[model samples]
Target: MVLDTVMTTLHVLVGALWVGSVVFVAGAILPAAVEGALDAAPLEKIADRLVYLSRGSSVVMFLTGGHLAGTRYTIETLTGTGRGHLVLAMLALWLALAALVEVGRSRLVDGLQEKRVRTPAAEVTTVFRVAAVVGILLLVDAGLLASGLALY
Candidate 1:
């Protein structure tokens, strides 16, 4: 029971950190950078730092989440229960978030290194929009999971 509680707490905490960072970047940092209110250099630096944090937190989340899933639910439960469905949904969201962040970071780096040329605002906006949507959805799903509604 103690182990279960610890794993759950770690999973939620790390997931929160990951989602919070993405939302902040999408809602604030990207917009400011795209609008020229922020410098490209600082934006790049922030992105680099966030990439490390996001990736690290994601790993922790995966480890704890996997443990919880493996220990708490059997294959039958996973396929037959609402909580299991939520788990699957969360997994898909995680994959989507990972792809968006990795691809966006590469593009951001390319834009930043292009001889003082800013990455096109439209491109950044697209990536930010997609990430923000995914992040928001993840938060909502998490809330449901926490509320036990995911077991419905």
Candidate 2:
């Protein structure tokens, strides 16, 4: 029970931080850079931090989420119930979000390396948007799973 609480807490915390950061980058920082309100050097630094946060959160979530699933679910339950389906869907969203974050950062990093900022930010804006959307879906799925659904 204590393990469950700790894992759940860690999972939620990391998810929120990573997702919130992505949303902020997509909704504000990227736009600011595109509009000439920010510079390439600072944008590159922020992108590096964003990538680091995303990677760390992804690892933490993978471990904690895997532990939670192992403790609470089995092959049969995971494949045969609503909550199980939600968990599976969340897993998919998690993978997609990870990929999007990596790819978006790659775009920004590559652009910054080539001595450009606004263009790269503009190019990667849509990717970040999609990632943020996926992250939101994962959070919503977590909520649905937590709404007192029967545990298997």
Best by TM-score: 2
All models, RMSD in angstroms: 1.6, 1.3
Candidate 1 lDDT: 0.80
Which sections of candidate 1 miss by over 4 Å? none
Provide the global lDDT of candidate 2 against the true structure.
0.92
Q: Which residue pairs clash in candidate 2?
A: none
lDDT (CA) per prediction = 0.80, 0.92
Query: C-alpha displacement of 67 in model 2, angstroms?
Result: 0.5
- Angstrom error of the Cα, residue 60, model 2: value is 0.5
Winning candidate number (lDDT): 2
TM-score of 1: 0.91
lDDT of 2 by residue, 82-132 (tens): 878888898999999999999999989999898788899999999999999
Model 1 lDDT tens row, 1-152: 99999999988888878888888888877877767777667877887887898789778978998999999888887889998888888888987887788778778878778734245444766886797688778878878888996674
